[model samples]
Target chain A: MSQTHVVPTRVYYTIFAILMFCTYLTVQVAFLDLGALNTVAALAIAVFKAVLVVLFFMHVKYSTRLTWVVVIGGAFWLGILLALTMTDYLSRAWGTFG
Target chain B: MLPDAVEHHHPALAHQFDSLAQQREAAALGMWVFLVTEVLFFGGLFATYAVYRWWYPDAFAAASHELDILLGGTNTAVLITSSLTMALAVHSAQLGRRRLLLLFLIATMALGCVFLGIKGVEYYHKFVEHHVPGPGFEFEAAYARQAQIFFSLYFIMTGLHAVHMIIGIGIMLAMFWMSWRGRITADYYNPIEVSGLYWHFVDIVWIFLFPLLYLIGRHA
Candidate 1:
């Protein structure tokens, strides 16, 4: 018989703390001059925070392999949408900004 | 019939499902599929924002600077806390702790409302500043038109997110009613778990939105 996994409250608290700290870090890092890296830093932090939430808060870590497939598949498709669109726009030479 | 009675069949288990576990798994998988569609829906907007921001980096940065980071940051914290409470709510439901489940759900909804209230305040400030992306909309003469595009994407993206939050709150209300009626249990807490997934997904959207819209221009 298969049993469901129950996460401990302690883990939840720990994740919550980490997320809050990251939130603080992201906001603070925005004040510094990182040039092109500013967007990179912000997006990187955002991605980290999002992964934490997905694994812990969304219970994807404890989920079945099939669930993992669905989650990763979604992200993969989003990547396709963004990547394909950006490649076209970035490679083109436009005369004026809209 | 005798075996079913001896097995103590649960009412929550639908006829098609052989067991409660199967039902739970199916429900979760269904919700994840739904969320995938949502990811793509919002992905389109993010892609559009990227293209425009790439084209008009200066205007995007200048417009992004107009956003109140403090309020946006506070809303991020609030939304994250709500996600925690929501996770806790699911945990409580898993453990069959009815009271804690209800409490956490209420706490989550309250935090959700607070986030919206703060968002409303931010929007009002934008309106007062003539930044709502319409004819009356005003900005620096250099890039006023591009800035309008920024605010246009801002309202649409965040506006759709706000709509999702409102829908999430409505779902929580239904969950609250279900729990209050003693419909949820350790063996049949699919609704709460699915609802939590939706809530967390919403939080994830904001996780990206806060930085993209509010922080991208701070260093500039």
Candidate 2:
């Protein structure tokens, strides 16, 4: 029989607490004046929260290597979509054409 | 009858799979693939939001300020709590704790509804304020047109997310009933596990949305 790993319940509680705290931190930080750092801070916090959720709540941390591949691949593809399109759109302002 | 025909069977295991683990693995992989496509679907909208925000940074920032951050933040916390409940539900399922499973499932669904109810209040506020992005839409004349674009994307993205929440709530209800009947067991809880994945994905989307939409120009 193949063994299934059961995560301890306390771990879920810990992650939940961390997530709630991060939410509060993000909202509080948004009230500060930090110029461009505001956007950077907000997005960075959001990404951090997302990583915690995916790794802990979704059990990708305890999942198989194949599952890791799927998760990373999805994120990689999304990066490609966002980066490639932004490069084109943002560069349009440089006036390359006469 | 052939000897092979007399082989013992596990109720949840399909005949094609060599073992239950393999069946569960296949199901998890299939769900992950579907979730990847979902990421792409929402990724496009995120891209659109980026383009418009870039084009009209001032208007985007100004328009963002008009949004009620308190409400958005509350909804974010609510959704995160629901995800916690969802993860707990999956945990309960894995342990074959029927009562705990049902309790967490109901908690998750109730939280989802609460999030939606708050969203409804926000939308009603928008309607009364004429922020619904149409002919009747109103904003400062200087940024009215650009702000309209902002409101348009806001409605589309959040509306789609709300629709997903509605679907998720329905799924939780069904699972709640199934758990009540004892269809879920320690040996077979793929439905709860996969649904947890879906629920977490939705929560992840909002995790991004709340910051992107509500925190844009708050400091300005």
Candidate 3:
């Protein structure tokens, strides 16, 4: 039987601490008037926290290449969904809705 | 004795799989595929939300202010911590530590319940404030209609996410029961690991949800 790579407990704790810190940062940043950057900053922090969870907690970091393909393919498809839909919406004339 | 009777078979291993590693890999791959579908399921709503929020920034921002950051932020921490416990649970199972595995699984479920409890409180506040986005819904007169759209997306997105959380807790319960029965051991802990993936995926959805629903419009 092949041995599975065991993630150490301290690694979990460290990831938890970083997630908590990012949560605090996102909330605090939200209250500041950074104009357009507000949305950017919030999303950036969220994406960072999500990557950590996906990599460490979800074990995708140690997953096989086939697993990586599925994970990345899923993300790529989501990007298509968001990007294509937004391009059409943003390009339309405002009067078209009314 | 029959020749076949001389071979010992792992109860968890199916006849088709050559080894435990192959079985575990197949299980993990299948679970990830399911999660990929879930991503798109939630992604459509996210796309809808982005378009509307862009079109009606002021109304969306004003509507978002009604969400209490304190509660939302706390829930983010709660869910993330639950993810940690879940990872630890999977780790314990890998080590064949049944008692620790059970402890961490229970902790993960309790935290999940806490998150849903907080969500219920927030939803209650929404109802009390007439933010339910239907006929009786009310907001500032100018932004009322667009704000209702915000609340509508809010309810649908977070509501879907909450449903996922409830399902995640159910999955954990099964894991707990199986572990209690000693069905899960270091040699075959695919169930615990796969379930952790589901739990962590739910947590990741909230990781994005908190900021999009609660934080993005805060400064406006």
Residue-wise lDDT of candidate 1 within B139-175, one digit each (tens)?
9999999999999999999999999999999999999
Docking quality category of candidate 2 according to DockQ thresholds? medium
Model 2 Cα lDDT, one tens digit per residue, B129-161: 999998899999999999999999999999999
Which pairs in model 1 have colliding backbones? none
Query: How many backbone clashes can be found in candidate 1?
Result: 0
Please give the fraction of native interface contacts (Cα pairs under 8 Å between A and B) kept by each candidate: 0.83, 0.78, 0.88
Q: What are the Cα lDDT values of the candidates?
A: 0.93, 0.92, 0.92
Q: How well is candidate 3 docked (DockQ)?
A: 0.82
For candidate 2, the lDDT comes to 0.92
lDDT of 3 by residue, A1-98 (tens): 56899988898899999999999988889889999999899889988998999899988998999999999999999999999999999988766675
lDDT of 2 by residue, A1-98 (tens): 44567889899889889988988998889889998898899899989999999998988898889999999999999999999999999999789677
Q: Report the C-alpha displacement of residue B33, candidate 3, in angstroms.
A: 0.5
Itemize residue pairs with steric clashes in candidate 3: none
C-alpha positional error of residue A97 in candidate 3 after TM-score superposition, expressed in Å: 14
